[model samples]
Target: MADVVIIGGGITGLLSAHYLAAEGAVVTLVERGECFREASWAGGGILAPMHPWRYADSINELVFESESLYPALCEQLQEKTGIDCELQVSGMLQLALAPEDEILARQWCERRSRVCEVLDQAQLQNLNILSTQFSHALLMPETQQIRNPRLGKALLAALQTNPAVTLHTQTEVNVIETEPLRVVTDHGVVSAGKVLVCAGAWTSRLIAEYSSLQIKPVKGEMLLLKAEPGLLPYMLMCHGRYMIPRADGHILVGSTQQDSGFDKTLNVETAQLLQQHAQDVVPALEGAPVVRHWSGLRPATNDELPFVGSLPDRPDIYVCGGHFRNGLAMGPASALRIARQIVAS
Candidate 1:
């Protein structure tokens, strides 16, 4: 039996396996599908929380720490695997905020010592891509983003090359036995000294009887549009929608929150609506051809905080899922914390 069995192969699971193996623990990671093909690949990879003041401090704690770790983590991943994750400080421009919201944003940034600038209508007009709909905006100059698909590829390569880690792709865990600490899967059974479930959207269903995490699949649909490089200089957000521009001029316009259960079918109308939203924010993208339309299930909780501890009466089994849309932002620190928790015990 391996020292640790990780169920799920998303960012959290892969990072946990990396940290555990680094701590001298043999890890067995099982994924129902290909590794890093789920939300980890579909996400825009914004490294900061969307609206920091809205979430609990616990969420920010993990997000900021993960943000700090990402530079070194991406550097090491590139050096070891020869894959560039494309981590960059794209920054963010939040427009169309209410007057009270602007005050709260400034107060929150002041408390956190975060660099923020309030741009008036005249200043906002200087942004070439922006529409005249928004008169004022808040600029977060320190926001960073990564090419998540590349990051996923890098992590998978790193884990595959690690001698202490074993990976099982296309393998689904059906039953988890606590007494013997074994997981019965599609292929066979895996026994481990400890089990860390980072299964994301599937976490609740997999451990429903043992855990009451209330994790549900919140469907998010996105559209990718082709634009000129540097057409949009910043990540733009307004009314809960965002446009994240890649270095290669692919702008990601997303997303709609539907309470759809495990449904990943693409909706043509929704994709069209997202395109309209993108054009509304940046007039230059008026006739931009949409390159791709995709959907990913975000693991959501009622309180917007992830479950990152052992289950009740099940010290040998731990959970680190239900991160909603912030999975990419908070994944690394959460993985490191859980790995340390398991190792210390």
Candidate 2:
């Protein structure tokens, strides 16, 4: 039996294993499907929440905590794994179509002491962004992002190099028994001194006997358009939709949040609509051929605040799921908290 058994191989699970192993805990992670192919892979990888003020303070706390820890963590992952996750410090450009959120953005930054510079329409002209008189803009220069796919690969590589950690792929966990901390899977039963459920949208179902937690999947669709590097310098956002430009000439435009259960089916109509939205915001992408269009299911909670920390009455069992769309941004901090709990116990 391992010191810790983690159920879920997404960002949260991988990072948790990385942290726990670093703390000298013998850890094993079980994934029902390919790790990182879920919400973590489908995310934009932005460091900060999209319009953070709209979220609860608990959500903001996790996001902010992770923001301070990502740079060092990412640097360590790259050095150890030999994979460039493309952690870009490129600033985020937020264009507001209405005055309400514009004012709220100001308040949000000021209250939190976050660095945000409000750019007037005249200043917006410098970005060459097509906008109307009602549009407002801000530049978050301190914001950071990563190519999530590369990050996932780097994480797996890092874990592979660690002898203290074990990773099991394509292992579906059907039931979890807390009496002796055992997990039943198609392969076999694996018992551990402690069990941590980080299964995201599947968390509720996976740990149904443990908690009455309600976690549902919110489907989001995205498009990857191939453009020349430097075509769009910053991560551009307007009207709640944004385009992320990668150094490798991949521009990401996403996404729509709808409660679509666990369905990950790609829709042509949604792709066309997102493509049009992207082009409408920046005419430069008017005819850019879409390199890829995909969708993923986000594990969401009732209030959008992720469930972190241990389960009640089950000190040896832990949970850190329901992160929704902010999994990539929140992974490191969430891992830190969970590791601290395990190490302390």
Candidate 3:
């Protein structure tokens, strides 16, 4: 029997397997499709706290700790897999279109005590390429971003190369056969000492067979645009939307949240809205050709916090999904914490 069985080969599952294998545990990861080909690969990779002030103290602490762990995680993954995750420390700028929003942004900066600068109209003009519609802006210097595609690919490669770990792809887990923590897949059944489900948006459906936890799928649509260097140097946020620039001449503009369950279709309205918002935030991107448009579902809980740790009734069964929009940003630390809990038990 394997030391641990992780269902869902997204960022959380892959990272959990990496940590477990490194600790000399026999780990096996089962996935329904190709690893990291789902929402993990589709994310924009912004490592910000998603409005740091709005989150609970526990969530903020977790996010801040996770942010600090990224550098080492990136370095180790690059050394092991020879893939660049493209971790960038460029600050994030949250522009305010209304007076209330500007005041809220300023208050957040003050409370956090992070290095933030409030920009006036003249200072906003300095970012000449971006739209001049914002009345004020708050710059957060500690936030960071990463290339999620590269990170996902690297994680898949690293997990495949780990001798202590086994990966089964194209294998969908139909039902979890608990007693001794065995999972019933379409191909066969595999038993492990413990089971951790990180199935992202599919968690609720899978868990419903046994547990009554209510996990919902939140749909998000995003756009990818190719642009030249120095087009937009930093990440831009406004009107509950974001535009992230990459070093490789690609800019990611996103995203719209909807309660459309499990629907991954890219709607025309969402694409148009994203384009309009991107253009409104950065006028230079008005003519930028959109290379790709896609949508993914984020597993969300009622309280917006992920369901980590062991399940109440089933101590041997654990969960790490329901991250919503902050999955990529919080992946590393969450995996580490869960792995430690498994190891200690």
- Using TM-score as the measure, which candidate wins? 1
Flag regions of model 2 displaced more than 4 Å: 129-135
| Model 3: colliding residue pairs | none
Best by lDDT: 1
Better of 1 and 3 by TM-score: 1
lDDT of 2: 0.86
lDDT of 1 at 204: 86
lDDT of 2 by residue, 1-345 (tens): 899999999999999999999898999899999888888888988877777778888878888898888878888988897788888888888876467777887798899888888777777667674645424578878778889999999999999889999999999999888777899999999999989999988899877776777889999999999977887778887778888989988899988987778888889999999999988777778899899999888999887778887778788889989898788888899998998889889
TM-score (C-alpha) between model 2 and the true structure: 0.96
**What ranking of all candidate models by lDDT puts the best one first?**
1, 2, 3
lDDT for model 1 comes to 0.91
Clashing pairs in 1: none
In order, the Cα lDDT scores of the candidates are 0.91, 0.86, 0.85
**lDDT, residue 153, model 2:** 96
Error (Å) of candidate 3 at residue 50 is 3.0
